[model samples]
Target: MIPPATPSPSAPKPSRQRQIGGLEFILLMGLLQALQALAVDSMLPALGTMAVDLGARDPNQRQLVVGIFLICSGLGCLLPGTLADRYGRRPVLITCLTSYILCSTACALVTNFDQLLVLRAILGVACAGLMVLPAAIIRDRHEGDAMARLQSTVGIVFMVVPMIAPSVGQAVLLVASWRWIFGVMALLGSLILFWMATRLPETLRPEFKQPIAPRKLAMTMGAIITTRSAAGYVLGMALIQGAMFGYINSSQQLVAEHFGAGARFPLIFAGMAACMACSNFTNSRIVEKFGARRVSHTALLIYIGTSALQFYIASQPNETLWEFVPMMTVNMCLLGFLGSNFTSIALQPFARSAGAAASAQSFIRMVLASCLGSMVGQAFDGTARPLAFALMVAGLGCLVLVLFSEKGRLFRRLLPPGTPRPIA
Candidate 1:
């Protein structure tokens, strides 16, 4: 009998010396992602004050504060993954965080809206690493259901940031100028940077590293776009994410002025975010047992049903906060399931090129989502109708794309029973 082939000595071990405790790994990944959430959600409470401070004349322009950041981040996301694939995840991430800290400080001191926006654009570029790297890191460590579970677990912590971020911003505005919110953001970025530099191990395999060549990069990206499973899920994610971003952009207006939540806007927003956190917690528990497709596909259907009802409610002439908030909250909860699972599924096909795949998908997804969000946000006319309509359309689009990817099938596991899961 032939002897068993020996494993190559020079092969890179993904878990070699990188095996921090599972809980620590999850927390680090989650906090890295939460930085972006904090950047967006915390600023929600202060958009009005910041606009007045910066001499903004048009109310619609204030959405640009959030909108510009998201768009720039999307554009910036296109490169980090390619560079990370060549250089390494650790160095690239550290640079991004350093930039984030510096940009946050500059934003705190801006004298005018244009200066603030320019700084925010740069800051968004830095923040792109926060969005892309965490997913790539998880991809480096796990795939399929394990990846979905890990993403959901991290999402539990990520969702917590949005839950309390508005409250944090509101509290800051109570004692200081809205600019102090940027100061707080800078401080948090500093702490996260320190934690990352000291504790997180690099996960990129040695063999996966490649030169940053244009032809190679273009080919990798082309492959990603051509892969039906990946392309479909990426498009679906962008559509759903567009709806979520729309809600984020218009949420303050809908909850505070239109629904008359006013000073209680932070509390109402936190309550809705709390439901999403709960959804992530629940997804973490059940994703592995039922599979990512089954959980997310079912959630997507429920989301569509919920969104249609929300549109109906919003169209009523005398709609109340009670009627609106619950449906919106449910839709947000469903999002917790969709975001991580769709990401995992789209990424399943790319093992060596995970970083590039993540980069391309994030760039496309965020740019498209931000544009759709800007449109939906601008359509706000002192009511929730536009946001609701956008969400319903998003859900339908997502379902269609998913159907195309699955070849008219849904909720079927690709893996058979008794297959052993690889340890991360």
Candidate 2:
């Protein structure tokens, strides 16, 4: 039976400070988010060279190289959040980053396609930890509006890495071999490890640290599945994420080979990344006025809308590169807007179990996105049309999921602080 009415005097005081220094938290968010994008997109510019070097007979298999890594990454995302719940976020993050660094090095060293695939799988496992811990850390200190603002700040920081990552990969490939990409990743992983070791603190209080025993883990997973509100928003986020994977995986090949842009493909990719960064920055500014749910919901509509237009454009004959690039950039920016806000909404409901919640979210997102991205990559035809079609379909599906999740409208009073009032 429900307990008798508790007096207002008996209610525990709400703590004002929920997280660490704002800038530090933002950087932390950036590094962790960077790993997810870097692990997949960093190798994009080199996919062609990678295929030739590894002597792969099938051209489509090139995308598999990226897809396989993501599959493992998605699988890896499963454990870290819960482990962070049990062991504390710092230790779990360190361990995962260490494992990722080693796996990334292995990616560089692998001589065979099978070996490379296995290494990518291993990298995926390591990435799970890095992917979820930051979200938990954010939850440790803030909720509702405060959480939204902090996350938006982090999103701005997180935005830059993915935008420039492919361009960076392309630039790297000019002076180095494909293996060196892994070497660079090794360096990134090491730096992130060192940074965490020195700067990161344990955010889950002693009273909150749960044991990693199988029973407890199972219980936590069950609770998450039962949390309908949390589940709905993340599903929407996952679809949006899958769309990104579809584009990044196919972009370099589509531009360099299909469009004959050659070395200029990096520049084209950079242009898109720049636009995404701008979108993230814009979200941070307007999130307070428009609210995360309203912004994200509207952005998803735009995201899908832009993709629909792009699809129609793709079907037309003799479309110039100039025609396609503008629309694609717009589509990715739409993604940037939705990415952070949707995630913030997903994480809003579970302040106490941020670590496990973050992990579950990451696992679902990465797994779904990886599978979809891989399929899109394998489906790539000589023209840009297939990529456009995949994006449109993903965008449309994401919209449906969001609508169903929210029951055909947006949520009211989305959280952490400085969260703008809801628009709809």
Candidate 3:
């Protein structure tokens, strides 16, 4: 099979004014992407409530609420790409968003833990479109370092949602039960759906459309698996995300139970998230100057170092919150520098199959990361040791994957012929 042709230097650019303006496009895509984060982070403060109300036998079992959603979301991601390629991005997205809204509402009414888990799984599937489609939309218009810059910009804005979600959840909990969290999610989903329906244009070009054939889909997915850069980066991303999810799954317990920060959980959580957001903003500004690979590689080393320090701190007797929070915050901030760059590199190979490519990437990252994270979370022994060790291990694994992906090269910029390098 022939590889898809790379867009030429002289190729016509899509008009930003024809569809949506640049700033509005970024904001819409950022908010759309943030829904997934909002769903996960906003519920952190309520995990204990959920466990108690749902009659969970083990405190750790509460994590399944987050883990199952990620797993099912990964499962859901497998199909939207093929569907978006065959149909149009707008239709597939709208349908999925509607399903997400309904699922969120259903979650608010579930009476038992099992019932809630089932709904959350379905919600994950519905949200799969939201996670995969927006990136495809960006790919529909941009590529290479330009795409990297836009992705980092979106990350900068998108990080704000996670920064505030815990506070939002806590606020809801102050007046109502945890059920209201889902209700608020539903409302937010509806607003995004409406905004998308009104403003988002069909970004996919007609010539790039693919038919929904089994053989064709298989070949495309196989291509993704066999492509060295894409596969390596995807695996590397999954490992890094595994570390992030470990922190997310255990954050509330770490802050409240381990450090006695129960009343200040939201504030502390928000502060950590703010660190990540600031890092993303910084990356957006500098990625163009230093290139995505260089920036991401540098950040990965820092991440590994920070993780090692965090593990040592967690291993000590009577570790202070001061020691743990700062190290973890720095580790998370490094992640902000890595996520978009890794994704841009992985998606660099696809043109016509952007949706399928995005789907496959999301599927692997979410599913594998969720499993690793769940393991770390369940190993909680009334200390931060498990989480810290898991991160350090994950960081080492991620470095190896990156090495393999780049063929043992690190911090090098390789731009395609005629592709413009980012300027300072």
Question: Of the candidates shown, which would achieve the greatest lDDT relative to the real structure?
Answer: 1
The TM-scores of all predictions, comma-separated, are 0.86, 0.82, 0.86
Mark the 10 consecutive residues where model 3 has the least summed lDDT. Answer: 1-10
lDDT of 3 by residue, 1-424 (tens): 2122333243245446445647787888888888988889899999999889988889888888888888787877877777897797989999988988998999898888988889888888877888778878877767776676677677667878988999999999999999999999999999999888887778777777888877865677688779888888898889888877877888888887788888688899999989888887788789889999999999999898889989988999999888888998898889889988898788988967675676667777888888888788888888999988988898899889888888999998987679988898
Q: Candidate 2 at 43: error in angstroms?
A: 0.9
Please list all clashing residue pairs in model 1, or write none if there are none: none
**lDDT tens digits, residue span 264-314, model 1:** 999999998898888877887798899999999999999999999999989
lDDT minimum window of 10 residues, candidate 1: 1-10
TM-score: model 1 vs. ground truth: 0.86
Candidate 2 per-residue lDDT over residues 297-396, each given as its tens digit: 8887787788888889889998778888899889888877888788777777788866556666767777888788878877887787888888888778
Measured with C-alpha atoms, the lDDT of residue 198 in candidate 2 is 71
Candidate 3 residue spans exceeding 4 A from truth: 1-24, 138-153, 201-208, 347-355, 415-424
In candidate 2, stretches whose alpha carbon ends up further than 4 angstroms from where it belongs are 1-29, 141-149, 199-201, 213-232, 344-355, 408-424
Full-model lDDT for every candidate: 0.85, 0.76, 0.84
On TM-score, the stronger of 1 and 2 is 1
Q: What is the C-alpha RMSD of each candidate to the true structure, in Å?
A: 6.1, 7.2, 5.8
From the highest TM-score down, the ranking of the candidates is 3, 1, 2
